[model samples]
Target: MSLKIAVCIKPVPDPDYYDQITIDPVRKTITRAGIPTIINPVDKNALEAALQIKEQVGGTVTVITMAPPNGEESLREMLAMGADEACLLTDRAFGGADTLATSYTLAQGLKKLGNFDLVFTGTESADGATSQVPSQLAEWLGMAHLWNVSEIKLKEDQAEDKVQELQAKMKIENGYIEYEVKLPAVLAVSRDLNTPRFTSIMGVMKAKKKPLTVFTVNDVDVDRTLIGLDGSPTKAGAVFTPSLSRKGERLTGDLDEVVEQLLQKLRAAGINLEIKSSSQGGR
Candidate 1:
């Protein structure tokens, strides 16, 4: 059987063009109007990784996301990037979701899709920045999880019985990476993983004819109460910009006197300076 892969993506406002993303202070919902949306940047890298895996290992790559119906634009983009198929989990009931609720909805969708060998997602959504959804989804699905992966390699070991065990190597942070136990796992990819390819005009035209599946929460056998506002554990009570206060002081003196004045200012501000000198002389 071929490996089955699914990449979870989000439709986010294009940060470069529309940086002013507003969150409802009371409802914790993102406003859609006037904000140009694009595929979440890191999620694009995740999709590219999935496509690369499929190209090398002979598998199908399915892209999935939960959002409003209009979020189909993101699906089309993924298809144009060479994903085999796309699935949308959309319903009015899935509104005002926090990371936990979002992951629950995705886990339900994954179950409905069936028989996935691996699941891919971005390390964090640009807007939320919570970095919680991928881990939560893995927990909900009872799968092993890896985070901050910059690269992935799959190796197949053939046994005498003609069975194969696939091992995955992932590049991690702190100049250290890990070799995971060969098993089905979920990975949250970092932006440094890969550069996503742009869709050609021909690819976009071809994507219009590709298969795009739409599923509601009910179609995925998800408990309605566990996937939306009712399912969320956290809420945003309020959002406000901090008022900026500007003040400055200027010191006119030689370098030593200036250094002394700076130290005095630091002391006045209750700042403690702990300096460690190097054992070896500065080069």
Candidate 2:
């Protein structure tokens, strides 16, 4: 049997030189107008990881997402990138979903998709950056979770005869840590993991003929009440940009004078200054 893998991907506004994003307050949505859209960077990396696994282990890659019907464009792009199948979970009920609700919708989709050896997701989304959905999906599905994976290697367990083992090298603050995990796991890939390949012309042609599946909340056998806004636990309260003020003074003088001036300014501002004298200071 071949390894079966699924990758969860998202579409994001393209990052231009200016790195600007526009959001619609009234709709509680992002306005992608005049903004180029592409695969979410981390999600692309996750797809790249899945492609690598499929190439080595001989399997199929399925890409899935939860968004508006128009979001199928993102799935088409994934198909162009060599995914064997694609699925979109879209419905009005799924609208205005926070991370928790979003994960619930995705979990419902995954359940309908049936047996899989692994699930991959990006560490975070470019727009939200909440980093909550993947872990929440893992929790909902009761699957083992690994996050921020920088590198991954799979070792087939011929001895066990029914399982595969994955060795993942993850980057931490201090150094890299390795994890030996069994298959049928969920992994949230980081941007540092690997480079995603561009869609080939042939692949694009092939994608047009490939099968793309669409599922609504009903098809997934999920409670309609458990999906969408009413099903969500968290709500978007408000959003506003903070105002920033800039005021500073530049001082030039001898070392001692500069120190004295800095201390005086701190005192004037009612800022506490802790001063200690060491024998080597002047020398």
Candidate 3:
């Protein structure tokens, strides 16, 4: 049976420019106005996993994301990595969304896209690292979900054009646990699951001809009260950089006296220091 797989991806600020990222003082939100972006690293792993499955079985891999219009670049890159199609959900209304609102918007986008046998996502985004979207999306879709997946094995169904089950390994602290997951499921994959392939000249050329569609809040059927910042329950409390200044002291005295003063200062600061008896060694 042929499968229809969807991989959810995100565009995050480039790590090289992390030092330049800042928070908006008034809104208490990440200020990403001028920062360059890249497809979140672990999200590439999720796309790779989806592509592998499509190769093992006859299937179509579609990449989806909720980001700014510039997110089209990330989607094009995914198409070069072998996704059959790409979808971008973008709008000013989507601004300042937390994981819950983001997931809800993505779920609505998926519904409009069509039914899928599976959906894959990275364990977390590089910037947020909340590890919440996959489970939250599953809840919105009312589907089974799993996270930290490092391995997968697909099981064929007797019925034509359908998938019923598969085995997946969830990476844990000490080891990994294997589970038989039923289809039409959401999986948040870890980076260790697979190594992503580089985009080749041919793949890049092919990607140029692939369909990359953009949708906005008006296109998808979504609740106005549950699709953006207004729907986000969590908000940033306080955002500020801590002071990194240091204090120093210099002792002015003869060598022995200076050493004693240093020792006393160290002791005053709760440091444990013991001087051995010098008479035994005649120091």
Candidate 4:
């Protein structure tokens, strides 16, 4: 049986150029006007998992991203990583989306792609680091979902007519939990799952021939009110650059005097405190 797999990828500002990234105070969104982007780190892990599965199960891997036209380079990189096809959902309306709105848009894009036996995503995006999209997207699709996956195993029955199942180890705070799930599931893969394969010259050459479709809100069916900043419930109250300058004051005296001086400084800094007097100065 041939499987259809979709990997959700994100284009993040390259770490090398992080100094160029800024926040748009008016919109409360990331300003990437000039900053270059690359495939998000953990997202490559998810794509690698999808590619490995496609190699083993005789399937096609489709990589999808919701970003601006500038993200085309990131998609091309994924194609070079062996994805058969790529899709980019880009629209001015998608700006300033919170996790909920973002996931809703991505879910609509996935719906446009038809059916998929499995979906892969990074455990969290580098910029947002919310770790919410995976479960939200699974909810939107009404599919079983798992996150922080450490390992994946495929099992097929011995009978001529067989069913394939997947068992995976999921990382937890204390250790790991094992789960066996049926097909058509979603996974938020951990970076520890696998090391992504490097793109070779041959892969790059082949990637040029692959299809990369770009879509807007007009192409995919989506609720305009539920896909951007306007629909998002959580809003940024204040966005500003923090001052990095520091001031230091030296305290000199015995331990008790130093402790008393520090407490005075804290109180002066607006920290409310109530003290009970110690008789005879005994602490």
Candidate 5:
């Protein structure tokens, strides 16, 4: 049976111009005025997973994202990655969304797409790195979800089954865990899952002809109170360019003396060190 997969992609601030990213303090959202965007790295992994499945079985891959209209370019790039269709959810009301609002809007966008057998998303976005949207989206759409998936395998159902169930390996702190999730599950994957294919010239040409749909807040059915700055529960406490300034100190002396100086500096900087002989040491 063929599958209908939807991969949620995020157009994050391109790493090249990360320095140009600014913040709108009043609204508590990163201001993306001058920065460019690229498909979030891990989201590409999600798309790659979808594409692999589409190739194995006769199926379709659809890419979805919530961003400003400029995100259309990134959506186009995703289409070139082999998605049959692309949808962009953009509107002024979607601004300043923390994971909650973002997931809600994305859920509405997915609902607008009709029925899907499976949904894929990066474990977290490159820019936000919140790692919350996938689970939240699952809650909104009422589907089971898993995170940090490193491998995915499917169990086929005979007689043209619409939904293909999956068995997956997930990364955990100590080791890993495996699960057999039922159909219509939401999965958030890590970059370790698969290598994304590059966009070819042929893909680019075909993408131009593929459908790239756009939706506004009013277009998708969503509660106004649950989908924007007003709906987001988490408030940005502070936003600033992370300072990478390092103070360089030169210790002019022999090895032992320099080591002693470094120790002194570390102590002064409030870093405690306990060296243990031939064993464990920390703090």
Candidate 6:
């Protein structure tokens, strides 16, 4: 029972040209034209986790992504990084999709690919950090899912070529909680999960020959009403640039007086400040 692993990935606008990114006033979406795209940073961590599992156990890793056709570039990069195969789900119908629609489409893609022992995704995409897709995708597929996973390990005493259980650490507010996850589940990994392996020259050249399949809305078993903008119930209310300018106040006073004024200003801004004497635990 060789494990079948699927890694969900996304192509996001290159961070290098972040300043060049703009919002379409009419569409209320990011204007991605003319900007380069790259694999979302944390998504590589998810891919790395999948690749590591495939290495430890007998398995095949398939990377999946839903984006415009240019997304093929991202898939090729994943192949170069050692994914056994890749799938690109692209179509005009997928435009303007919110988390729900996006996840729904991805669920359909997974369905078309057949069942897998595990599915991996980043906690969130860089462009849209809603962090909602993983859980929503799990819901659509009717599978158990976990997010913000910082670590993953195979449970001991597992049969060869088959993975039935996993030990994972989920990041919490102050600490992390661990779990023994049963297989056939989804995991949204965090950046700390693993460092992505670098692509070798040979791997890059070999990626060109690996299987890269493309699917459109017509290719998968999906309800037309449940996939793109029309399927997305939520829409952006507005898009605007926030002002980063801040006003500064000058304090004309001696050192101690200025410090007191500064503390008062901080308190006035709703910041709590506490000071204690040396005897009361003050340094």
Name the best candidate (by lDDT): 3
Off by over 4 Å in 4: 16-34, 158-164, 241-283
Prediction 3 TM-score vs. true: 0.83
Best by TM-score: 6
Candidate 4 residue lDDT tens string, 1-283: 5778999999887777766778887888767787666788999999999988877767889999999897888888899989999999999999889889998999999999988889999999777689999999998888888999989987756573333578998999989999998867899999999999999999999999999999998999998999889868789776666677778778999999999999999999988666645564785
The C-alpha TM-scores of every prediction are 0.81, 0.82, 0.83, 0.80, 0.84, 0.86
Ranking by lDDT: 3, 6, 5, 4, 2, 1
The regions of model 2 sitting more than 4 angstroms off are 17-19, 22-32, 160-163, 245-283
Query: What tens-digit string does per-residue lDDT give for candidate 3 at 30-140?
Result: 777878789999999999999988888878999999998999999999999899999999999988899999999999999999998899999998888999999999999
lDDT of 5 by residue, 53-95 (tens): 8887778899999999999998999998889999999999999
Candidate 3: the clashing residue pairs are none
lDDT of 3: 0.91
Judge candidate 6 against the unseen true structure and give its global Cα lDDT, from 0 to 1.
0.90
- State the lDDT of candidate 1 residue by residue for 1-283, as single tens digits: 4678999999987777544656677776656578788889999899998888777767888999999998899999999989889999999899989988999999999888896888999998886688899999999988888887876777654444211334444555457466654447788999888898888998899899989899986688887778788889887675655556677667989999999999999988988665635654477
Ranking by TM-score: 6, 5, 3, 2, 1, 4
Better of 4 and 6 by lDDT: 6
- Winner by TM-score between candidate 6 and candidate 3: 6
- List pairs with backbone clashes in candidate 1: none
- Candidate 4 yields a Cα-based lDDT of 0.87
Flag the better candidate by TM-score, 1 or 5.
Answer: 5
Error of 6 at 36 (Å): 2.4
Between prediction 1 and prediction 4, the one with superior TM-score is 1
